[model samples]
Target: MTRSAPVPAPAVREMDIDGEVTLFHEPTQTALVLNETAGDVWRLVDGERTADDIVRLLASSYGAGPDDVRGGVEAALAQLAAHHVVDLPSPG
Candidate 1:
């Protein structure tokens, strides 16, 4: 079965400045600043690409091996989830 892709939370507002991204969740009054790498990951979280697909796209963009970037990509996704900026699939 295909897993659903992660998506940004609807209430989250995103701002991009100088290649960095800032996310604000008004309901929670929480804000998160994402660096260049994390910002890239955030831009790709369109509810269409799986986390693995994201890692592959990033790796290809940087001409790096998928294994080399997977961990960091996963970490970024985890951070987004923790901040309620994105929703990830629950582990089965």
Candidate 2:
């Protein structure tokens, strides 16, 4: 079984273009722009919370049903992981 590694706090810097926002990370040159809901979810990744916990939080906070938030969070995390902005949790 794969073990989940502790998620680390992202080193983030943001820029506002007119009314739009984009987050930039120097290490991976990954630029992430969050829509309103995704932005809310993004704020919860404070290094202390696991990905599973994040999904749970999002479900409650956003009034989203469990399945939707779980799917969305997992997809977002996968994307972030691909960009090296966040680490993925292993099955263990």
Among the numbered candidates, top lDDT falls to 1
**Residue pairs in clash, model 2:** 2-92
Q: Specify the highest-TM-score model's number.
A: 1
Please give the range of 10 consecutive residues that has the lowest summed lDDT in model 2.
1-10
Q: What does candidate 1's lDDT look like per residue over 1-92, in tens digits?
A: 54478899999999876666899998899889998789999999999999899999999999999999999999999999999999997565
Q: How much lDDT does candidate 2 score?
A: 0.68
lDDT of 1 at 25: 94
**After TM-score superposition, what is the CA distance of residue 13 in candidate 1 from its true location, in Å?**
0.5
Per-model TM values vs. the true structure = 0.91, 0.69
